[model samples]
Target: MEVLVKDFPIDFVVTWVDGQDEAWLKKYNQYSQQDVLDVRNARFRDYGIFKYWFRAVEKYAPWVNHIYLVTDDQVPKWLNCNNPKITVIDHKQIVPHEYLPIFNSNAIELNIYKIDGLAEHFVYFNDDMFLNRKVKPIDFFSKRGLPRDTAGLNAIQPRYDFDYIHVNNMKIINTKFNKKDVMKKQFFKFLNIKNLELNIYTILLFFWPKFTRFFDLHYPYSIRKSTMKRVISENQNEYIQTMKDRFRSRHDITIWLVRYYALVTGNFSVRSPRVGKIYDLLTTFGEAKRDLTNGKHKMIVLNDDANISETEFDSIVKDLKNLFEKKLPIKTEFEKED
Candidate 1:
């Protein structure tokens, strides 16, 4: 039952954009699509995503050494997270409003940059995501067999590449495509339209949900912290602004970053062996193994053990102690400090 703990500094950065404020919500509801979008951007600029994030941080406090909750505005006075391990840093501390858009990735990247310089590893995530298992850091970095390739992974459309490329033109040109498939194929064709694959990353961000949630486990990636810090510090100013104009906000920026990680880095596996699902495809954990051909490799899922809620947090900590007994033995009779 011994659990494993590695000698590395581990933490998480999450966006919690608060959206329930009556006045803000009222004004937010009033705007047209563009106006509402502006208000939404402002909300992200103020609070990333709120309620689920608040609960996630509080529940996972024991497993986490430090939690960086980035916001669109000032840290709300109502947030007095008592966990000594948790630190709520506002994005505003680094830069002001108009510049918020460009530095969105830099914001999370900067946080990782700051911590990675000192710690061996760090994990980053969004608000709505949750871990269904109680997991240790070692479990995250452990290698699995080759990942399965699911269909439709490359099924994105291209015409939506930019604000241009009218619907009429799409209708006339891709007459063979059904209305539903038009978007995906158009997106694919659009990226290669000018023989320019530059915006492919952008298309992956907005359209590819399977790719986004495929490897949802935001666990450890063993990169030198200082290296990441340098990446953040060098480009913080320019990338921050560029990203703002390029993406809608934090979510948009994260989608681009994940795609960047997938396409650029070879470290990530394409399938989560534990769940048997293609990391970025449209299937639930229950349906994960169903699509696959019967195979030899078995997936070890970490349900509550992967990531647990606060209510069950203590029990999981105790379970880790049991696991540690098996993997990392220590003197049990050591006297408790007075």
Candidate 2:
């Protein structure tokens, strides 16, 4: 089962923004539609707990060869940019000049594979997602070098503006792959009983001849650098046009397209979805908090809601910071010493 990709050095990529940074806010407002961007927008709010994400990585996934902190030239005041294991990537470095000053994470993420010195095996993480339990390199990629993932079925039930992006990804995917053909060729892999929770969903969607949607997980996306490069190259025009967006747009295709491509092409290894879970910060605060403290999963996403008031959001963040401190108290080399 050995392969060259399995032996390649693995890197971790996480995109971050200091929503409170004046320079960043200025640029955000300049390009934002409201003449002034809403500083209180929950998506742009600076939750105080991001530091623990680095600490958790240091504690839980110490074997990660490098950690690339992708940002729009805004580094956290606490981040130790000089740390050898951490590289600060500016959007200008990977994205073309035309797409400079891009605030769209989808656009920035699409170009991460262009990172200097990035390895063949890499995983992309959102700031809110953290390595909760100790993990091995093999947890992300298999011995044969496929990205380990769960292939669960989900219909596009768009509840937010971003959900439409999944539909875009699906349209492109369905055009390139036949559902019936993929199912038959990769029957055992897709329906791998190891992922018992997904089997029922696969069976129920058996009649659908097209990929309506994939159960898009908020977990750190396990990606192959070559795969990303290939996906972008295949849909170059679509990506090029979409990358110009200064903010999230319904026209854009997401990184989930890469996952779907790999799944249909049988380039991924199946795993259980239970390894990581996403919990709402506003609606499931206690449940998410309890799971974090209990180390209930290997990864967790504190999915924030923009509808909550700033006061409530602040309180939740305050409590979350305390919980993370209790779990991963010691500061790592990634942070500046007080």
Candidate 3:
């Protein structure tokens, strides 16, 4: 099955932060008001890998129309800001003033659609996520402009206390659109439990056994700007409340909400990549390195986890730098010549 092709241009949006910047760190500390351990563990590791990220995109996904590098008043000194294809966006420009100095990624992500002149069809990427293979527009979207569904529901147990965010996301859909309720009434009558008090995860396990956490993909997310706008418009109060969260909270819904909304609305066509195509560097460094060395996968995510030892973390960074340099040694037009 193929989507009808159009002349639409696809843009790439990346959220990044330079934690080592003294000004940014001071601002974060002032707002965080937390101890060193809490602040340090807040997923703020700087492996100095943005250059490789750009290199990967330039090499494998050269068709990308524009690259929006979102940050908090900090730009990589080596980046070519003068490049017409690259734009540096400060958080203050998109996020509301009240949410200023925000350190939470969810807050920044929720407002990415507000970016001026962003394409209606865009791919959102984290600084740690990279394209590992040559790809075209079809890999991200169909010819009809619908995003390819690279995710499915899973029945894995929660790994963090904050996993309730996933539940909250489902509950929002259930309460607002009643999509889940409709599914329960039509397909899940076998359980025969009145007023099912179980959480969304348990309910999904019982009925749609394939429903998994949407976030495990850890790859670039193909998004429709208008869909996100409509979701926020319909759920204005909830959206505002979510944006107001200064830090990640159990009540806050994950940014994957847009993708979930797309799935439930049948706006996306499912396209599952082969197993082992996506790797999380922190936990699967060995496999990730092997995959990169062999050029086996289309995408890989280098998640920064503070729980790992400094030595191990440094080793991973060094190895990743070496691998990326080996694969993409030449700098693209996006970088300034040294």
C-alpha RMSD for every candidate: 13.5, 2.2, 5.5
Local accuracy of candidate 2 as per-residue lDDT tens digits, 1-338: 44333367889999988888888888887777832222337777778788999999999988789999998888888999889999999999999998778887778889999999999889999898988889887789988778999887778886877777888899898888889999898888778887777788888897797888887777999999999999999998779867967677877887888898998898999888888989988898999989989999999998878777878978997899889989999999999989
TM-score for each predicted model, relative to the true structure: 0.45, 0.95, 0.86
Give lDDT tens digits, candidate 3, residues 241-316.
7677776666676668898788666676555544225555568788888878877777777666656788887888
- Candidate 2 overall Cα lDDT vs. reference? 0.85
Residue 328 miss distance in model 3 (angstroms): 0.6
Instruction: Tally clashing residue pairs in candidate 2.
Output: 0
Instruction: After the best TM-score superposition of candidate 1, give how far the Cα of residue 332 lies from its true spot, in angstroms.
Output: 27
Off by over 4 Å in 1: 1-6, 22-61, 74-79, 96-120, 142-156, 159-227, 230-338
- Best candidate, lDDT-wise? 2
Candidate 1 lDDT score at position 200: 49
Among these predicted structures, which one has the highest TM-score?
2
Clashes by residue pair, model 2: none
Please report, as a residue range, the 10-residue window in candidate 2 with the lowest summed lDDT.
Answer: 34-43
What is the Å distance of residue 138 in model 3 from its true position?
A: 0.3
Better of 1 and 3 by lDDT: 3
